[model samples]
Target: MEATPGASVATAIRLISRDKAAAASSTCGPGLASPPWAFDGAALPQYGPGASAADPAPAATPRQGALPSEYLEASDEELEARISAAKSGLGDRVVILGHFYQRDEVVRHADFVGDSFQLAQAAASRPEAEAIVFCGVHFMAETADLLSGPEQAVLLPNLAAGCSMADMADIDSVEECWEQLEAVFRGRETAGAAPVIPVTYMNSSAALKAFCGRHGGIVCTSSNAAAVLAWAFERGQRVLFFPDQHLGRNTAKAMGIPLEAMPMWNPRLPLGGNTEEQLRHSRVLLWNGFCSVHKRFTTDQITAARQQFPGVRVIVHPECPMPVVDAADESGSTDYIRKAIEAAEPGSTFAVGTEINMVRRLAAAHPEHTIFCLDPVICPCSTMYRIHPGYLAWVLEGLVRGEQHNRITVPDDVAAPARTALERMLAVRP
Candidate 1:
């Protein structure tokens, strides 16, 4: 959905800086970065080979406080003990949510497993769940805390679990863009009232959600962007969608919003490259952001596959840029990408855009179709790489011993308003 107008851009910038600072302080990795139009090997590290199932897991550092010495070691037997202990103390009061990209072992323990949006809904619906042990990334845990009741505590097994794409759309950059847009919009308006709305993807932070709520905006997931955008348009004449520009562009374009009407807001630009006239005339102001992993996919890759294998249907995630999506036969969520390929007839070749790990997993699952990642180079979701099972046992063991580790609590102030934005999206019929 589109962003609501008059969300104070300056406030959003301060929020972004504070978020970056807080992330730097944590043991976990920084959150995801936005998607880029092109990849340069110099800035980004080469995607490493997938860690072997037989590879020794990272050993957990024992927490300084409580729990017995043997329990701290967290051997298979110790994990079994922790499982029994957790069952005894929490006893179905704790709900663990796992994302699809998470390792099999971690997924095995999740009481509810799905995409980020689904996980949030699952956490919010469980009134009896006193603690949500989110086995995804930091943002996912934060989402759970925001959605869950105040009495319930959300925990991230690994605080380091983060998404690289989410990191790209800093709150500071969003606020800066908004400030520039506001000035341009207000100066030109004969009427003093603002016309732009602020919309954020569900991948963003709770504070971002609060920003939307405070400014009369709404949150959206990939599955419901069209409906959300329709909601935003009903609220305002134009939208300033943050973080996921591709999602914004793709969704709006789907709604018949012309590409020229949806100019990107670049914080790096001196004045966001928009004339006062442009801001006023614009229907959608897409933030200059993207998913790093998905951006690795290229049009050249699609062309090469089509030439090499006739009738190869290309499927991709919407996180890829408009060009890549256009080149592909279809684009949607990771699940959607998988379903499209699975539905293809035998002897059909398929190219996919998303994390390499998932693509590889899908390739193995469906030997009938030739499934390959759109990017020739292997790229894992850098942030998701942190969610190894070793981290899982460490956090679970702490909970079993009545010790809180990596508790992700959204302050009441943030949660209160953030809930409003989220509720708006959740309330949508789609």
Candidate 2:
């Protein structure tokens, strides 16, 4: 029998690891066992069982309560039927928003599926939805809540499904970094412009978004990072971009910001490990954070793909390292990759450097082309895979009984400012 997309990816990895030592030991990390709920009660920080298993989960990452045995032990068939029936019962009362990085199992049930910002916009689009079931990570759900009506509760199927990359730049650390930067720039005001502007990536926490808003800064998605940076440059002398350093660096570099002007800020270090002069001269101060999944893509992978499939077009996410982005034929956001494949001529071969789930699904959807992940390892995002059918069943069943499980609610204080930053981002045309 064929396995579900969620389970099959892991199964494929286990089988491949038997012969291919490089794949098993690759940076993308080998897959883990069944029942992701096993890690629900884990004390140590962890993303449970998936590609990000090798990536260290921050100590502050949220943990989920043990799932009830009924849902945990129920067969896949039962969970699927229950979820379907529950959605049928809920009708227009709920809108399911699935992220592109999510497993195919959960994504099949999404009323609207897209990237984080797209899903948040979807949440806002459905005014009638009493609940927004975000089949994504914690930050994504928080975003949906911020954008959705106050009456509409946003529910995350699995509480443990939190983005590791987002957690890299916590609010406290960011505030500290901000204060240190202010101290360095205190006396060197550039007439009308502020010394630095805060720009939080969409993957960051809501508090960080609010921090940006309060600081006269803005929030940016990967697709609009360049445009947002341009907006920021008009308002401030320099940009302090957080959460995903690769996105900031790549976007700035593409806009003609030199490597010397873009400095990586290690938050743990005083002055972000920069001299006062370097900080003053910096055009973009990048936070030392990255997506574990995107970091797995290497220029070596691009080289191998080009050699193996001579005419293949290579496209990667800007979140990938600068070297990998430079090596690829093209680099853009997930939506860009999807659209590229959809518009390609039949029989076009392409190598995608994003999450393996998206690449695999795109490949299966567009059978005319040969589409594959640059990394040979089966790489479903660790947090994304956490929202399997079981959690979906649990959340939907609770909703069926008029109870909101794992609801994400941002306080009015944070929501207001965060929404401002988000609206500013919306105002900028990519």
Candidate 3:
């Protein structure tokens, strides 16, 4: 299966850099609580009172990126050669971390392939690795660098790669919403009312995580949202979840919270555009956030597919709006999407709502089933689409030449407390 036609490398890189700059320059004063460049370093909260584990000393090795096309079109043998060269050149000094959503070609080269949190942990574990090559998006690399020691560098093979949903809840917007909420809740300690506990999804910035940490809250991934929500409800009467309303609503609804109990908080509105009574009565303030890519999927699309192909089952990501989710047969993470399709009976038809690349890849992987994106026009996470193969080649070769191009580094000051928040989430066992 072909990847949705990617933009030219220069165009893609320029677009991403522009967005990053815009994000950086934006005022983080209101509605958002994180800096565009926010990151958490190693000075994490010591979970134990004494004798916390020390990070291992970084191991030095040769430079990385000996081949250019190996990242894109290399054959299995050529790919092995590239990996062998990178390993032989860098030894323990380099660790390649891949996200679950990455292409198999990229995952094949990963020293570790897991979810976001898992990838960050892998980066931290490799104290000997001087350089970490991240095969995901900008946020993933930032998280890795935050988790890894300062001496270690986190390199993104394609700097253009980013998560669109992550960009939606900018720091300014979040901070502004918080202030509005704070104003509403002031001295209103009435019984049966919900107080605020901000719950951010893992697909957010370190600054957002820091905001959570500072405000006595925690972060959560899709798999652990239920557990995290349970934790939040224990601490406060009302919970504020950002960037992904679908996840927040789905998780809370599953926990027996009525739809009416979860009110959408529009950050664009004055006072979150929610009345005090609405805010006070609500158990969860679901942000008016969504994944543009996932939101494109609709009940109509699913119905059309089912009619076109009898016995078709619809599956979608939790980032999708609640209506689409309600219309689908199942919903889950990217891994879950792949697994559901893989495990489905042969000759089954599946309409998936998510990024187009992964959906197309799944279709190619399962020849026995009819797999299609819920959006027939072929929609992708435009930001993630920014990481074209050209940039990958350029970065890889640059690494080989010891010329670092796009290195995501989280400073010590921010990392210290940010790691505390991240560690808190990590410690919340399933």
TM-score of each predicted structure versus truth: 0.77, 0.95, 0.75
Segments of candidate 3 deviating more than 4 angstroms: 1-88, 100-114, 188-194, 345-347
Model 2 alpha-carbon drift over 4 Å, by segment:
1-31
For candidate 1, write residues 1-430 as lDDT tens digits.
Answer: 1112221111222233356664343212222222111111113332212212112222221122233345445554556556656656676777888786765445657788778988988998898977788877767888888878888888876554555456556666777776776676665433433487799998887778888888888998887888998988877789888788999999899899999899877777866776777767789988877776677678999999888878887888887888988888888886677677778788778877776656765776778878776776433464555554455665666676676677988888988888899889878866
Give the alpha carbon lDDT tens digit for every residue of 1-430 in model 2: 2334434464555455555565555425544545678787777979976656766887777788888899988986898899999999999998999988887777889999899989999999999999999999999999999988888999998888998889889999999999998888887767788899999999989999999989999999888899999999998999999999999999999999999999999988998898989988899999999998899899999999999999999999999999999999999988888999999999999999999878878987888899889997666788998888999988898998999999899999999999999899989998
In each prediction, how many residue pairs overlap at the backbone (N, C-alpha, C within less than 3 A)?
Answer: 25, 0, 17
**How accurate locally is residue 314 in candidate 1, as Cα lDDT from 0 to 100?**
84
- Which residue window of length 10 is worst by lDDT in model 1? 33-42
| Model 2 pairs whose backbones collide | none
lDDT of 2: 0.87
Estimate every model's Cα lDDT from 0 to 1. 0.68, 0.87, 0.68
lDDT leader: 2
Give candidate 2's error at residue 71 in angstroms: 1.1
**What is the lDDT for 301 in model 1?**
92
RMSD of each: 12.1, 2.4, 11.8
Q: Residue 114: error of model 2 in Å?
A: 0.6
